[model samples]
Target: MSFASLGLNQTLLDAVAEQGYNAPTPIQTEAIPAILEGLDVMAGAQTGTGKTAAFALPILQFLSAQTRDSSGKISVRALILTPTRELAQQVHASVVKYGAQTDLRAALVYGGASINTQIESLKAGVDIVVATPGRLIDLMYKRAVDLSQVEYMVFDEADRMLDMGFMDEIQRILKVLPSTRQTLLFSATFDDEIFKLSKALLKTPKLIEVDARNTASIQVEQRVYAVDEDRKRELISYLIGSQNWQQVLIFTRTKLGADALAKEMCKDGLKTQAIHGDKSQGARERALEEFREGKTRVLVATDLAARGLDIEELKYVVNYELPFKAEDYIHRIGRTGRAGGTGLAISLVCEDENYLLQEVETKLETQLPQQWLPGFEPDLTREVKKAPRRNSRGAQKQRARERALGKKPTKRRR
Candidate 1:
């Protein structure tokens, strides 16, 4: 149905029309009515199903309908918490775009940016604040942000927030918000944790899911190529060049892998960049901008770094390395096939990562069709060799414990 049929005001309808969306997506169709009716909602839709607009529009409408004092001071009326800086910025952009026709004000707060600037923005009085947990908590501690006035609360990508270890922060945030406020939770996937959080956070919420749990987008065509780990870079380069793909988003499990893959692709004469937590926020933004503008032929990124990437026409996403977590596989490939666009997701599966691949496929409930490219087929007789273990957090903690006890660190048992 049209957005107008969803009972949105003319201003919101104008914004929607300007954005070239004639109708509500399934999530929007199910969620908008419930939200406008003052019901708390827990929504689950696969990536790129217009979930943002489902909550954003109603938030704008709900806030705009309220009476305000002539004092012109702003206290946050609504708060949207995202998991990452990129996602926070992405949601803030949507809020601005949809609420442009109204008198509402919005601001974004996240880490890796100037807290001073965010403080100044908050001081100017904003009706809505879209923020990441860490930065928002920092602002709260400094008394620069006031959340007690929040009438509506939203947790975008709730699953991702929990995955990033934001549950404690989320509880802290909830404690500060008005207990009577309406709450909305949106996620691409749901698990026990998300369900438990919803039970605690929402009061008799309406559950809206457009797709089955843990399923990938039907619009995205997924395929896998069985290749040796050493030759994955070569296979990706060959596929991109031979297939004439202009822009591609590639996923790697580690920051080092992302950097190395970008370097390899660039040496092959393709413009490429890597984005991860290790890079400065400025560097990440610049790389994403270049990729969006078609200046970079490839963008290699770790899973956590790619959240909140909203590319309009991205056609290709490659998994150079499978993620340790199955749900991350869904989030990685979701970078493509956004906003009703047809896209392709290719996985370069090596022998060592087969177990990870199996876990992902089991969660997805479908086998990714495997194709072997000429000259890049895996060696049949070779046993799958595991990569050298990196010094992960657990390893680092073990070493720290040994150091504290005045003992030499032993090799990990992995």
Candidate 2:
């Protein structure tokens, strides 16, 4: 349906149209109206579902249409909390874009940046504050920002925030907000934790589910490659080079793994960068910018990037290592195949990660196609007495061929 029909005024309509989205997405259509009515809402919307605009548009309209005090500095009227700084930035950007026609101001609050700058912006006045939980808490401790005047609260990626262990912080934030505020919770999946959160925070909220819960993007082509743990790096390199893949986003389980993999790929003559929590905000942003601009062929990242890091037309996503949670698999693959574009997601599964693969399949309720790459098949006995086993097996049947070629067969130690 058109955004205008969803109760948006001409200003918001023009802003969305400028963004080239004449039609409201399913989540937006359902959410904008309810939010305008000042009702609590619990929504299930996956990545790339225009979930940001669903909440941002209505909230911006609400703030702009009202006549609040314009003389004094504006306190925060809306607080949108995201799990990570990247997602907070994503949500804030949407707010800025949609509210371009209004006089309302928004501030971004997150760690890794100067709190002094954020405090100054908050002091100047802001109608909306999009932030991460920890950084927002820090501001609260310093009394840099006031939330007592907040009338609207949104928990973007609610499931992820809980998964990242922000429930206590959320409770603390909730304690400061006005009890009469409208609450909205948006999540990609609805688990027990989210259910409890909604029950505790929402008041007779309208429940909306736009897509199947815990499902990956349907536009992605997913495949699994069975390779030896030691050969996973090799297989990924070969696949990218042999298939002429570009803009590949690779996910590793650990920060060190992401860094090492990126370094090795760079040594292999591939343009690569790594991003994780340890990297400074500037460094992380630079790496992302370079990758998006095609200056980098590959971006190796930990699970922290699975929820954020939006890249338009990203064609390839590689799971160098599977995540502990099956739900994370969905998020990692969701990085590709966004905004109605098709993409390919490949997982490199060795013997140790077979269980992780099984968990993913169980979560998806369908087994992914498993195949072995040429010359990089799973060597199951590689961890055992491999040298002697190879020699006993005539060094993989090549020793007999070597002796046939008149090459000396070296004596074995007794």
Candidate 3:
């Protein structure tokens, strides 16, 4: 249905039209009406489902309807928390674009930027504040921003925030917000932790799931190559070069892996750069920008980019290494096949990562086709040595931690 039917005003409709959106996405269609009715909402929608507009449009309309003080002073009325800087910036841009016709002012705050400027913006007054948890906590400590005045609160990418270990920060932020306020949570998936979080925060919220949770976009063509660990780089290089694939986004499990793979690809004459938490914010943004502009043909990234990096018409994604979590596999390939564009997702599966690949297939509820490229077939004769049998539980736990941290196992201290 059209956004107008969802009870948006002409101004909001005009903004939607400007963006050439005649009909609302499923998430928006379900979420906007419930939000306009003043009900708390917990929505499950993957990336590229127009979720930003679902909340932003309704929020803008709600804020615009509020009575304003004649003194020209602005008090924060809404708080939108995101997981990462890139996602924060993306949500902020959506707010500005959709609220362009309204007088409500919005400011963005996140880490790796000038806090002084953010403080200045908050001091100048903002009706809405979109921020990351860490910077928001810093601003609260400095008394530069106040959530006590918040009438509406939004946790965008809630699952990702919790996955990144922001549970304590979320609780702290919740303690500062008004006890009696509307809350909205949007996430790609809702595991037990997210459900528990919803119970604590939402008051009989309307639950909406736009699609089957944690499933990859159907528009993406997914395939995997079985190769030896040492030959993964060679296979990927050949795929990119032989297929003439432009604008490839590659995901690895660690920062060091991202860096090393980018270097190797560049040595193979492919324009490549790596982005991860270790890179300066400026460098990260520049790397992403260059990749988006085609200055860099490949972007090797760790899980830091699994959710937030948005590139329009990004047609190719490579899982240079699979994530430890099956849920993240969905997010990694989501970078491609966005906004109705056809895309391709390829994974290089070595023997050690076969279990990881199986886990992803289980989550997707379908088997990913294995394609063995000519001249890059795996050396099946090379025997792999299994780790020594120990206490299965303790050994598995240690391996799990190492996989999550993207590190090799370290010996225990005496």
Q: Output the number of the TM-score-best candidate.
A: 3
Write candidate 1's Cα lDDT for 1-414 as tens digits. Answer: 689899999999999999889888999999999999999999998878899999999999999988887886767999999999999988899899999999999999999999999999998889999999999999999999999899999999999999999988998898898989999999999999899999999999999988998899988999999998789999999999999998899998778778888998999988999999999999999999999999989999988899989988999999987777789999988888888889999999877566667779999998877789989989998965454345364564454345324458767675
Per-candidate local distance difference test: 0.89, 0.86, 0.89
List candidate 1 stretches off by more than 4 Å. 384-414
**RMSD from true fold, candidate 3:** 2.5
Task: Arrange candidates, best TM-score first.
Answer: 3, 1, 2
Worst 10 residues of 3 by lDDT: 388-397
Model 2 C-alpha lDDT per residue in residues 1-414, reported as the tens digit of each score? 678789889998999999998677788889999998989999997788788998998898888988877676677999999999899888888899989889999999999999999999999989999999999999999999899999999999888898899989998998888999999999888888899999999999999998777788889999999887778888888888988898899998777788888999998889999999899999999999999999999999988754677888999999987777788888888888877789999998866456567778989889897898778877766663223352254442344334323457655555
For candidate 3, write residues 1-414 as lDDT tens digits. 678899999999999999898888899999999999999999998788889999999899989988888997789999999999999999999899999999999999999999999999999989999999999999999989978889999999899998999999998999899999999999987799999999999999999998887788888999999888789899899989999999999998888788888999999999999999999999999999999999999999988764688899999999988787888989888888887788999998877677678778989899987878889888878898464344453564466458546678755443
Candidate 2, lDDT over the whole model? 0.86
Q: What's the CA RMSD of model 1 in angstroms?
A: 4.7
| Model 2: residue 117 alpha-carbon error in angstroms | 0.6
Better of 1 and 2 by lDDT: 1
- Model 2: residues >4 Å from true position, as ranges? 380-414
